[model samples]
Target: MAGRILVLNTGSSSIKYELVDVTTRDRPARGLVERIGEDMGRLTHRAGDGPPYTRERPVPGHGEGLEAMMEAFAAAGPELAPVAVGHRVVHGGTRFTEPVLVDDEVIAAIEELAPLAPLHNPVNLTGIEVARKAFPGVPQVAVFDTAFHRTLPPEAYTYAVPREWGVRRFGFHGTSCAYVSRRAAALLGRDLAELNLIVLHLGNGASATAIAGGRSIDTSMGMTPLEGLVMGTRSGDVDPALAGYLARVDGLDAQQVEHALTHRGGLLALTGTRDMREVRARDDDTACLALDIYTRRIRKYVGAYYALLGRVGAIVFTGGVGEHDAATRAASLARLERLGITVDPALNQMDTTGERAISPSSAEVPVLVIPTDEEWEIARQTHALIS
Candidate 1:
């Protein structure tokens, strides 16, 4: 608590670390270790008010990646002693509702939930284990991406699946949604309990959650991150029978189909690229279709959640695509005039720097674009746990 809090977000093949001074809200250092287990791994480390230090070397595993991160801090600047380490673990299943100090039981629970998040949890566990080893005395807290959504009502979380499969909607982007929703309410000068919010988190992996009175009442994703709006590469929603159909026709197994849906579908399947910026730049029919599919899916969720919320006070956009892509934002909410949602062309197209509303002057619902701060939230939580 007396020192900095280091937050680690371990993705499938990347490690994102941030060292924050919780007392001052100052990030003394931050970096990313990308392309792990590859021939050439890259690390970009930066300390406060300094040029970033860059390195390209072979990082064979998450442990090596973390060691390189430590080296970066040693060589660059900021002393690498953290009082606590916060990890962004992707799945908590039904056990974790808040950040918990990692122990063997917590590790076992995370491992048990790996089947639900095959792409994230295992790698996240690797980071936790490695960090535990590297800083044996430091308190390491596991902050779940699904934890905030634990407040989801039964109706919203329950899937219409066979009860025996033990499957249900476990929404992602909860941390981002939590931070933005709070910020949106504060910006509007309204209490979160009195507001109905539609939160669209459109990063590489996208989701739409309907928050009623600061709690998730409904969300777009179900069971896995693959069941929501169109994302960078993952297919958001598809027919359940498609897997069986593919198996019958193309000899694809369930896992193979799941992999395709998780990695090869969505924008990549529709167009030649996964980035929305790339898709927006093309004038070809393929890119046009991809954009349509992406925005249309968002529109559908907006409509569905609007009906669910009955009276929505605000529509918030966060994450990479939501914050940056003006065209996608405009197109996604284009036909919601009846819902009193409209974006001003001037404001929407302008290159605004930080959190700001983009709705039309007379629009009933405030359409806001709040840049998410998940790392800050993770750091805060980690600091709180240690203190």
Candidate 2:
């Protein structure tokens, strides 16, 4: 656990990996196997600062994808032996509250929870199974994205429905939240217990989490990732009765409605493109409305979380869109001066980098941009568990 820990984030069709030396927080090697099961797949491995070693081939499955990773490390330079292999499992569903060493029981549990995260847990298990086989004796650990949100109080996680149905909010993007919130406390020079934070993890999949005393008190994502903020392709916060309505009128079942909302809704359904940059690039009315809808949802969440926490020490933004989209950072918090939360236009729009505040110096609340690193968080957790 003290040595190199290989972090594998297995997606539906891609496997993202990075080798972290827990002692130094450095990635001696990193790579991705994308377009798996497709006619052609690509693996790009970076060992050092020099040019990356790239390969193009057919990666039929996760097993072949991992084998391709081994091939990359073997040919590119860094000997691919890891002290432990850490995996990113998307959902814990109250069954797992922390990182667990992978075993047959763990694998079965992950498989069982696939009903909660049909698209993620299965592939995550595949990575664990393949890594166990690939490394033979190396320890395999699963660091769930939902584990960090286990601290949610009963009220925060409970749903107002039939108790026999058995459902509650299980927030996602917890790995990112765990890392960036700690970094936020460090940047503010305050103990995490003393800070109340609202973390907006806006990426392809977005969520807003309220963290008090370094614990998740509430989150936007509910029983599934589809219930939160509008994402790249997901329509968040839809009417609960839509499924029944569609079934009655259009002869569409619940599955069809879910499929459309999960894959074809959001920006894609609104603006013909899922990319925020594309919507931001155009001045057309359609694009303008899309941006407004997106940013407006974020502002609503911020206001709600602020009311929930009563006092927010900082608003942290992380993930691909959150960290890079200056326009979003500004628009989301627009017209909130009454709340003593205001972004410094110059500072917010500046071409700066790394953990930094964008709020006006005199503002009561600070807005920050802290890029998330889930790979390192998994490696850190894995190291701690095995150490």
Candidate 3:
């Protein structure tokens, strides 16, 4: 129970592993195996103070990638003995409302829910499978991204569509929201159960969640991650008729339309690039329009969630884009002064690498930037299940 917990976040083409000591909050070793199926794959492993152990070679599959990770741990340092392996499984659907110890039945259940998250669950399963072979008998826990939003009220999660289709909102970024929201409560010197929060997790996949008394009352994402705010590549809220229109005129199928919406929409469709930093750096008309579209989506969600929460104690921004992009933080909430949401220009624009408020002291709703630590959350949940 006192040892390290290995957290594995496997993507379509990458595996990000971190060895975390929950008690001391220290990451003894952390690294990535990127471009897994590519001919030129890379593995970068870090342990102590010196340079990270790096490897560049063909990683034919995730199995090979996991083998390489084991090799890195063996060669680098810190014996690869983890108390538990925490897997970040993207969509648990309605079946898994909490972290469950992984087993044959759990793996089958995760596979059954694959249709809900075709891009993520399959790869996440691969990580689990590979880890089981690597560390036999070690407990592996599946920490769901949808678990935190299980607190969503029926009204907030229910869709207006045919109930027979079994479609409704199941928000992502729940893990990040859980961590940041609790940290936000601590920063404010209040209990999480007493605070009303609107958490904006902005990264490749962005979402706005309204947390009332520490419970998710509403969130932007619905049924799938593709329904949230405009993300790096996903088009958040598209007209339902547009896909039908495309099918009729362009001979595109539903899967094709979904694929385009998932991989080629949003900033990529607007500006030919998915990186937000690149979009903000350029002052061209197209880039400016893309920025406007992105921030406008976020601003709309803020207003909508504000109305839902009735009163917000704090608006916490987390994830890569939320923590570092001061311009985005400012632009998203620019003209909301009437709603008691105003960011102090001096504080908002300053470059700081800590959790701090950017809103004016006199503002009714304080706006904060809290960095998310999902790895720690995963490890904690995994530890709770096993120990």
Candidate 4:
């Protein structure tokens, strides 16, 4: 359980990996392979913080990407030898509530859940397959993003649609939620089972989850990652009839509408750019409106999740935007002083980092900024299961 674990998070066009020293809770080495299958690609390997070992060429596939990573590790320092390899498989549906060792059956099970996470599970399974071949006898574990949300109650997970569709709310970002919610309790010096929290994971893919007694009760995402908060390239929670309407008026099929909503919507649709930092930099009306819409959506969720939890101990902010964007942190929770939730202007705007309270000292509900580490959590789980 104390040995090193290699964590791989394979995206559609990228492969991110970390060689974690679980005993120390520190990463010995980490790297990323970007633009995979393209005419050209880039690989960055960071070992001891001297300078990242870099490579650029035409990487053909995920298998090639894995090969490049191994080469980078060999050329760089910290020889890559892991007791177990952990993969970030995005969807586990209702079948896998915890990390499991990848076997032939597990591969087939993950493949069967591909419709639930078409963009994620396929590539995740590819990573598992390649790693299994590369490592030979090493253990490969699939740590699901949906695993932590398996605790969602029936009322929260149920949709009123039809029984034949077999569709319901299956939240994403539960891995990040699992790590941060427990970290939040540790930061607050309270028992996790006694705390009620609202965790906002504001990354390119964002979600807001309500955790009571360390279990996910309700989450912003439903059925897919596309149903959560407005993400960088994803439009979250549009009219349910949008696809049908587009099909009628524009001659666009449901698939076209779905593709547009997933890739061409959100901040990109409004301001012509998906990055929040770019929008925040410009003072134009378009950017201002985009920010307003984004923050307002978050505010609404805060209110809704707050109601769901009745009385909350803390409202946690994690992920890239939540951890660094002070303006977002303030704007998202603005005018919530009535609920005894208020961020201190000084603390909120500080250039500091790490897990710290941004709420006013006397505020009833603490607003905290805790950076998430899904890789570490995955590595720990992998090590645990391997041991």
RMSD of each: 1.4, 1.6, 1.6, 1.6
Q: How close is candidate 2 to the true structure, as a TM-score?
A: 0.96
Model 2 lDDT per residue over 1-387, tens place? 369999999977789999999898778888889989889999999996758999999899888998899888889879888999999999988999999999999999999999788778888988898888889989999999999999999999999999999999999999999999999999989899999999999987899999998999999998988887989889999889999999999999988999899889999999998888888889999998988999999999999999999999999999888998999989999998888899998988888779999997778998999989899999999999999
lDDT of each: 0.90, 0.91, 0.91, 0.91
Off by over 4 Å in 4: 35-40, 58-61
Q: What is the lDDT of candidate 2?
A: 0.91
Kindly give the stretch of ten consecutive residues in candidate 3 with the minimal lDDT sum.
Answer: 9-18
The candidate that wins on TM-score is 1
Stretches of model 1 off by over 4 angstroms after superposition: 37-39
Kindly list the per-residue Cα lDDT of model 4 for residues 130-225, writing each as its tens digit.
899888998999999999999999999999998998899999997799899999999999999999999999987889999999999999998878
lDDT of 3 at 257: 97
TM-score for each candidate, following the candidate numbering: 0.97, 0.96, 0.96, 0.96
**Cα error, candidate 2, residue 141 (Å):** 0.3
Q: List pairs with backbone clashes in candidate 1.
A: none
Each candidate's number of clashing pairs is: 0, 0, 0, 0
Q: Which segments of model 3 are wrong by more than 4 Å? A: 35-40, 58-61
What does the lDDT come to for candidate 4? 0.91
Worst 10 residues of 2 by lDDT: 114-123
Error of 3 at 32 (Å): 2.4
